[model samples]
Target: MQITTEVVSGLERRLNVTVPAQRVKSQYDARLKRVAKTAKINGFRPGKVPLSRIQAEYGQGIQQDVINDLVRDTVFEAIEQEKIQAVGMPNIESVDVNDAGLTYKALVEVYPVVTVNSFDGLTVERQISTVNDADVDTMVDNLRKQRQSFAVKDGASADGDQVTFDFEGSIDGELFDGGAAKDFKLVLGSNKMIPGFEAGIVGMKAGEEKVIDVTFPADYQAENLAGKLAQFKINVSQVETAQLPEVDAQFLQLFGIDLAPNEGGIEKLKADVRKNMEREVKSSLRNQLKQQAFDAVLAANEIEVPKAMIAEETTRQRKLMLQQFAQQFGGAQQFDESMLPDELFRDKAERSVKLGVLISKVIADANLQVDQDRVKAMIAETAESYEDPSEVIEYYTNDKQQRAQVEAVVLEDQVVDHILAGAKVTEVTVDYQELLKRNQQQQG
Candidate 1:
């Protein structure tokens, strides 16, 4: 066997492999002998079929099988000999497999050679948030309001009030689809309806009929309805005003808690609120730090990323997202491929692929290995949260791929931790109110 490789690009190569015809003939003959031994014909006794007949019957099938096997075997050998790390599966059709001194060529995309410059002294300010008594008090008040009651009213609908109404909407005097509802309950200040819809409903009194005109959002999901104007003939059914419950013993009891259960009910609530708030703050900090780390690595490394890796990642991301979207739309429904374009997530996919390559390089450079015990501990931790912990653990154990995914996550987390150790993360102290404002701004 003789192998030759030509670099197509930075990460792509064309491999031309030539196998001796004598080798192919020898294997073909050996396969025919094996088949003859197991062959059973009408006249020939079992395990005594003639070689000529066996060859004539199965020669093409045997040749194809042998070609496939040799291609796979030699492809790996070529990769190993050339010291190439492939991105995904090679383009098999690009390979030309034939007989007379068997000649085959395969087009393969290999992983890029990544070089990390530095992660040290990379200054990134992590906004620190605190949960104080005031924040906790606000949280408790909000919780109390969630347990509020509504009083029936004969007055007109107002902000913060609930309204029940029947509405028929039409586009240019012709009723458009999904624009009509019977006795639909809507909250005035919830912002659930299109921009002007809720505002128009706000001043409507019970039993009053009015026509409300509104335009659909320019980027509405339904292409046919985007930026279309519609008039709704609405009849208000009822109006109601909310009455928040007082944060006292009765309200506390509603929360499955008795004041005597803790030294101070308000203080206990404050502690719980603080713990939850701290978790959110930590999560935000982690996300910010990771993004900074990723940006730092990308900026530092000037290596040309493999296009094949990005394309593969893009394909995987699309498939995973489409599967999720299909499940959400309806079970067993065929996904509309036209909805998701390659341009939609091409940049993100490329960034993700590059980040993955950078991380893997760092891990290899540091000689980092996945800790088996840590993976098991993570599995246990995951199962501990479930009611049937043993069953969850057993399920994970049985699913090799799922278990490996979990292990990869654990390993990645370790890598992030290692990067954080070297990263210059500057702590920014912020009050609870200020942090809350910042968070709200970020979300906005």
Candidate 2:
């Protein structure tokens, strides 16, 4: 076999391979002999069919198989001979199998050579957070709200009241599509509906009928409804008042705190909640620092990632989003791929690919390896929140795939730590609530 190579623009190369006609004939004849061993045809027994007869009957498919095998067999050797690191599978094209030779082209993306001077000059912020008593108090209030109950009340609905009503909305005196409902339940202050829609129901007594004007926000998701004036004709069927249980034995017990008549069970509950909050705060702090480290490294590096890697990453991200949607909405097969265009994930994918290349370089230069002790500790921390942590730990420990996933995360954390070690780090104290808010905004 003889090989020639061409650089087809950035990161892409084409390998032209040609096996001599004699070699092609040799492989073809060998395949024909193998086929004849299992050959079955009229007036011929197995292993007795003529090679020429088998070739005549199945030459087309056998030729394709031979070319495919040759392409697989020779392309890597050609790539090695060219001394280029290929990223993914080569796309074979311009295949020709005949008297002259078996010739083809394999187009592939070559991996770029990565270099980094130093992360020492990179600046990163170390988030310093302490989950205080006030945050714990806020969390306690939220927990109470979660366990809050509602009761049927014959009175005006106010903020926090659950209201069941029927309403038909109209624009310009004409009812619009999806502008009506019957016995739709809503919390007056939940903001589940458009601006003014929920507020309009506040203080509305059961059995009251009214029409209120509402203007959709200028940035509303529906173009037709955005900034448009609409009036809703509403009938309030029922209003239910929220009832939060007092901090008593039952409420305390609801949180696994066994209250004693003369003891400070509420304080005990707050302490327990505070411990959980502290755990969350610790995790949040680590995540914030890791993110900062990643941003520092990414900002400091300029790398050109292969489009093929970006494309693959984009596809993986799209499929992950679909999987999440399937878990949330229960219809994986019903989703249309076109709903999520590749453009939606392209930029993120490119950034991720670039950052991945940088992270890999850091790992290589630092000679980093996955720490099994940290892996065990991370797994233990994760399983701590479960009812039966031992079972969860056992499940993860015994499942190689799951354990490897955790190990990968551990190594990523180590990578972040190494980067931070080299970075000009400064501690920034952030309030717990402020940190949470910032995290939410960043995620969005």
The TM-score leader among the candidates is 2
Which digits, one per residue and each the tens of the lDDT, describe model 2 over residues 1-444?
789899997789999999888877788888888998998899998999988899899887888888888888888989999888999789987898777788899999988788975888998888888888889889888888889899999878999999999999999999998999999999888777988898888989989999999998999878998999999999999999998878888888887777775556989888878878888888888888888888888887787888889999999999999999999999898897899999999999999998889888889999999999999998999898888999999989999999999999899999988887778999989999998888778886
- What does candidate 1 score on TM? 0.80
On the 0 to 100 scale, the lDDT of residue 53 in model 2 is: 90
For all predictions, the C-alpha RMSD in Å is: 4.8, 3.0
For model 2, the run of ten residues with the poorest summed lDDT: 255-264
